[model samples]
Target: MSTFDDLDAFVATRRQAGLALSPDGARLVTTVAELAPDGTKPVTSLWEVDPTGEAPARRLTRSAAGESAAAFAPDGDLLFTSRRPDPTVEAGDDEPAALWVLPRHGGEARQILAPGDGITSFEVARDAGHVVVTTTVPVGPAPEPPEGTQDTDEAPDAAAALRAARKKAGVSARLHDRFPVRFWDHDLGPGRPQIRVHDQLAADRLTEPVAVVDPAGPTERVRESAISPDGTRLAVAVDVRDPGGASGATGDRGDPAAVRVRLELRPTGGGETEVVADEAGADHEMPVVTPDGRWLLWIREEHAAPGRAPAQSLQARELAGGGTRTVVEAGRWAIRSVTGAADPDVVLVVADEQGHAPVFRVSVADGSVTRLTASGAYGDVVASPEGGAVYAMRATMDAPPVPVRLDPHTADQEPAVLRGATEIDDVPGTLTEVHATAEDGTPLRAWLALPAGASERSPAPLLLWVHGGPYMSWNAWSWRWCPWLMVAQGYAVLLPDPRLSTGYGRGFTDPATGAWGGLPYTDLMTVTDAALERPDLDASRTAAMGGSFGGYMANWIAGHTDRFDAIVTHASIWHLDGFVGTTDGSYHWVRQWGDPITDRDRYDEHSPHRFAAAITTPMLVIHGDKDYRVPIGEGLRLWYDLQRHGVESQFLYFPDENHWVLKPGDAKLWYRTVFAFLAHHVLGEKWERPALV
Candidate 1:
């Protein structure tokens, strides 16, 4: 651990093993970014590797500008969205993201659409003829011009006259002003784009698309859409509210109202949609139709009471008969993903149970499931087309991700190291499971990373890392860069999945339900106290850190306790009252907080801002300026308040980053800043002061 290198080499080595293999298992696409010579901004590129070894790996798209959401068409052609360097539109205006297609073999890339169309996402049809593009269209007529349009004294100016005429005709003056704009806005907005079957083969095709599913009404908020294997049905997962009203509730756990998904049958010939399967209350996900088109398999998250794990049930519906049956019951844990195997009667399901996400096969007939892979590392498992072999991505904390092939028939589950061949060799430290007792004496699971030279006599500085989601968990596996970097610098790391973390029964995560600042915060205190009890940890020099919900905890901890010498909070919510008003999902937060306007005392009392004056620990706040979730304004308010209260605080803002720092250079810089802050405050190391701006 003491021999760890700089952040650049570390990230590069880590990324080597992070490439995603295509479904065909022939091509690999991964994001790569290089630091500009001046080290200001990153120049990003998406590279491809041919697993067949027939051609050398090549860079498909290169630009100083950032790009993401890259994927491959069914034919292995590259399709990605990119923001062009030169914008033809005015600043602060929407510069439409253009979709580009590049041949796998390599050739000139072609831009499919121009700017101003507001194309968000496009998926090629199974036949590869036409792509179903999602864009926003005006809902209603735009605002009209000034009242008095025709004036003889005005001399009928051409531009003004044209504008006046258009306004009189009910035309919108600005693009965004047009109503009923429907685009593929992911995870945001009142309405999302529905999956429309488009025909590329048609010669007289206009951009106008026939709506396969109407998302205009209150019954739908399409989160994601997937087409059937035979392309005959569309599965849409939406969080539907009440008709003509909002689904209001207390708590961020989404609307307490029932959740349902509709499996609509789409005939090749245009016709009305037929509902194949419909279920209510449970949160449904990963709706995949079997290859034979007889059954549709999906993962359903069954809602739990205030203190229980959301039960994950695997279910399948007979497409033709319109009857549904459970393949797996609502277990203590949740399922991740499911896919149709070559065996039409069986489906592959991935679930996280007891801190590990494993793959299993479930029979469509009797609902019996067989575990395929038991390793709980955070990785992906894919079933082969033949259903005999399974390919997986295995990751550990210290090691990069590797591809593992499993043959259930042979009972072989060995993994082949795919990436980071030269890196992560002889990684120091061992992973150990530790448990802490919550307020009610319930056991909370956690992972502890011992320093390379850890011993009772030479206790190492402890870095307590809290996970986000208040619902997410910290599992064993490849070491993350931040914690590993700290460990390499001679600090021990303790990651606790306190109450409210997933994987455990819903009861564990329910502690944070309506008691955001109550039981959950107590759970953190319990974990931290347990960490301090370890003889291998230096309790006097402890530091705490987390992001998102975890970030909120870090801020709360700093304000409440003087136990930690330093703290780092990222994308954290400092004030629940402000968060409910400023965040993109303010409604969700309001629901979580039990009505911000009505329950002002509950919101304010739970917020870290209320306790800011009690903070004695030097803190570092890292946030993304463009983050809509727990916006940068939240961080700014915290920093300004902390400064006003005479607490030593530092704030770092990544201008172009969103909720998560995706760019390589920014990530490296972020790690560097965190390391510097921790080293100076916790380890008493000399470091340059961070540039606050």
Candidate 2:
């Protein structure tokens, strides 16, 4: 059996993700994560892959603190962010992640920039070596304020000093006047996100940082940004709260106060910023400057309403004062990213189509779209500076992400995979698509992973694995919600893309917008029934598992049906009314289901907790206290409801983890516990608790 069957071995397997191509397209850099010695954390290191696929990949960097966000400088030097201690500077425990550069000619990697609180993300100019970095700066009033006034005019240049003073004085409170006081796992704090520019960077030291996009408060944040090829201008996507609501009302029904990501153009050197796109009810994000620096391209998505789902389109504007044009129409496919091509006339766009996220070339003059890659999902796309080839990290359900080279002109091309650090010899199962029809005659499809060697006489138990981001699809490989582990245990894992899933056009998602337990649930069931029709799958023995929105579906399944022998829900929302008000993005949820107070019928009908008394299946509830997206209260309340109703259930809680179990040790335990619970309920084995639980 492969490591996928063993929790410890699976956790130890080296994981490869992210890709960066050199300016000449001769070298490819990828980040490989390997379990640390303590087996608690996964440490990442940089590796170089030959773009030609002739040379075996070689390790480029190794450090205890790890390195990531790799990008290439205009001069071919490799730049990455790391928390590794600098040799020249005195080491400190509070050292943040700093920018480091590895010379292309050779020699040691030198620390270039180390600022307080470190950098989160950065971009390098293609024609110029200018660097733009995204970091956090301290905000809010000092410890003791006079009267009722605050230090609103605090200088951003003295942010480090202010932060140090606050820390030294043991004042850790953040007074927030925004709609959202917290995010996914952490509170919106004493510091907010800001972008800085480094016009001059050296090997020995970093230049004094110049704040370019300093937001007003914790509410506003830089969502995405890109630097021009000439390094003269910067395109940034900043998220800000809507003044009133989308319809200019006081956030009543049909109108909700939402935080939208708006596009802005600013000079690399300090100057007035220009608002490029700030339409109401829509978000403009993922700005990418064309290679020739003539056009700026980005994705514009409208906010979802009651019966309507969000619509996205690829939009472009001429940098030198021209009207914006729609390069691609809305509802064609869910656009993931846009990469500048060597020829600015044609850009490479990666989008979710059917079951795969393939690369497509779109004409800038016209909106003609052409598929480039045949299969698999791609990320970190880098076009060749000279124009023949494109490089990206490609991954399928059966394979982890690997560096691959693509032919820009070829359609449906099977890209040649470049040898990298992570490699898989064999998988525990085989992936096949299962198709069926919903009760309404709608076509439904799912990816089913069947374990090796299972006949009609000896069928494998089935596990229905629903994905989160009801808006997302099961098109790419996911480290957190992998199905291979369950497949390795002689169980068939069925990954379904239901009504709310992307890649199936816009109409498919509209049916499940405010109706969580309606079409999406039926679509899942329809696909699950199709998978069970196979002779190798045992329909009599089945289980359901999901996290986040998928977890909400799992809870819904538990109450609505008894088809499954066991259910596992992680970070699930039990009560709709409770969740919408408590979630990090309440405004977004309100847009979908409307006001829980005014729209009581919808909440009462769709809420999973309302039907909790009907659940008869054994369930394992898992939650992390730091998860503000779904919140731990939902899990605790669900556990209480299940126990009070005399339903067979167990709660697995993590105080340190967030929505996902990220730590290697914690992830191992999560799988072990799931495996044990399923073995007992679905396979009719004795109840055995996981060790260290």
Candidate 3:
């Protein structure tokens, strides 16, 4: 079989993530997930890439469990977390992840910190030897921090000991004092996620850890935390919900599950942390301090609701306690991420622009946003400490993400691509930007890919591939949802940013804020219709497919119209009323959707199930049992709905998967089944099921 046609080669494609620059700006590190020699599972390991684009990338660590969350310590040591056991120092091969440090000069990686509860993630202080670690511990009384050993596999904490005891007793019951008892796929009861501060005592061991910011109302999970360069101040995002104790029976305004997450700035020494940035109906997260420690910059996200439009703006405040001000509100585009630069006058930012995720340098002095990269998706941007160049993972429709270094002033002028990473089969297609006007006269756009062989003589089949995260723009290189895959099957894929999509200014999204079924759905159809006008696209043979929010739209399309030959929905929301409560966080959707009990109009009007009886086209319903965001109940209910309605449908269920199909074999089967289904419906070919499935 050809390389592109082989499932193993497709799965072996480069999977790179998490880029970090050394303090001296000489060396760089990134984690890549590659198939092991045994070809059983994907393993993540640290790779040292040349920041100057002068040399080939080299592997830094090797292990079955692999390494992750790497950061350069102040002393030039590479700090990372791994589950691999220490060779000289006895440790469990499949044990919980522990912090390991590799010397700057080339030596063996030594186990530094191994807490009993185990560390999920860790961040090294830029100037200080302190380290901030996030871990899950038993919710019982506090115990003395036992001295952890570098050369031993012993866990020195009471929490870990109690957990073992509970398992031995076969006690699985968990008492919940909060609204969300479960997250994406796992129950949150056995242990609660907490942030603890620890110091690197020496080269081999770490000091005792201490819980600093445990709130009183409800248990909070620290999603992301950043420490100041000097290690004096810590900015953290604590995800918590308001467990209502108001006057009403069901609590304030009949919504007991309302939640709000805030970013707090506090001294690293564990004192009262001030709420640096908090909006009534918004979320503040990923607070990063400037290199000079003068400002704490954070991304503010306004929730979209019935009358209000969603917005993402970069806001900054004086580190000495001052009111926050909008830094780049004029841009209108949602800022993806912001990284502080050595130059205090400017900070590097990444945001969606039209159909591309480009790098932007926002000047703090006048709040001017400057486009750095011309046109492509860029993320994991880090400014050099020496103030020379900016480094990021650049990806486009034509290529996957590759580490690149760009001139600080004119990044797009001559961005140097760093090599030594695995390459993939060059996508055999032509990528073009296309636009259309919505019903309300709002201009919408999408990135369309047409197969190289497409022609008017034998036009390729059209596939309206809707992107997930209805709010997120389809800009980056996505191995999971590459349009090239379908293009390889002689199909043209239309990736539209219908509505509520970031980029293209605020006016493009505000109109369809909470009204999902209104303009956004039409915008999608509008773009799809416009793309079909191309001579190389055969609109008569077309299909529509999406996942998550896109899946919701696919379900909506199945119910509203029968324009396409078939519809494929994965991890979709079938029943709106049951979904809002059963989802990972109800409060997030409740603000926009309102309570299903009180404000039933939007839920009833926007829900796909309300119009399921009108579906006439064949559909393939795909979902994973482990998906807690849109639980298995949704797919099960959706399948039964179609069966009862006597609609032509097929079900693709994954028992061991989550919202995303991550395994190599599973993903191969997914693409195979999807193509086979499309072939039967769109191409009018005999249905030939995937060999393995």
Q: Which of the numbered candidates is closest to the native, going by highest TM-score?
A: 2
Q: What's the ranking of the predictions by lDDT, best on top?
A: 2, 3, 1
Question: Candidate 2 lDDT, tens digit per residue, 1-693?
Answer: 577866777778888888888887787899999988888899999999898999999999988999998999888999999999998879998679999999899999999987788888998888886788888877754444336555676434466668767878898888776667788998876677888877767546657754467765556777668988888888989888874444322433433346888899998777778999997788899899898999899999888877778889999998876889999998777888899999768899998888899999999889887899888999888899899899898999888888898988888999998888885556787999999999988888899988887779899999999999888889888878889888888899999999989999888988788898999888888898888889999989999999999999999999999999999999999989899889998888887887677777988989999998899999999999999999999999999999999999999999999999999888988998999999999999998888886
- The alpha-carbon root-mean-square deviation between model 2 and the true structure, to one decimal in Å, is 3.3
The local distance difference test score of each candidate is: 0.64, 0.86, 0.81
In Å, residue 449's CA in model 3 sits off its true spot by 0.9
Off by over 4 Å in 3: 1-3, 88-90, 141-156, 219-221, 243-254, 411-414
**lDDT, candidate 3, 469-499, per-residue tens:** 7678888778888778788888898988988
RMSD values for the candidates in order, in angstroms, are 6.7, 3.3, 3.5
Error of 1 at 635 (Å): 1.9
lDDT of 1 by residue, 609-686 (tens): 989889989999988887877777888999899999999988888888877886767777787788889999998889
- Per lDDT, the best of the predicted structures is 2
In model 2, where do residues sit more than 4 Å from their true spots?
Answer: 141-157, 209-211, 216-219, 243-257
Off by more than 4 A, model 1: 1-4, 11-135, 138-194, 199-221, 243-263, 276-282, 302-312, 376-380, 408-412, 419-428, 439-441, 476-481, 597-605, 691-693
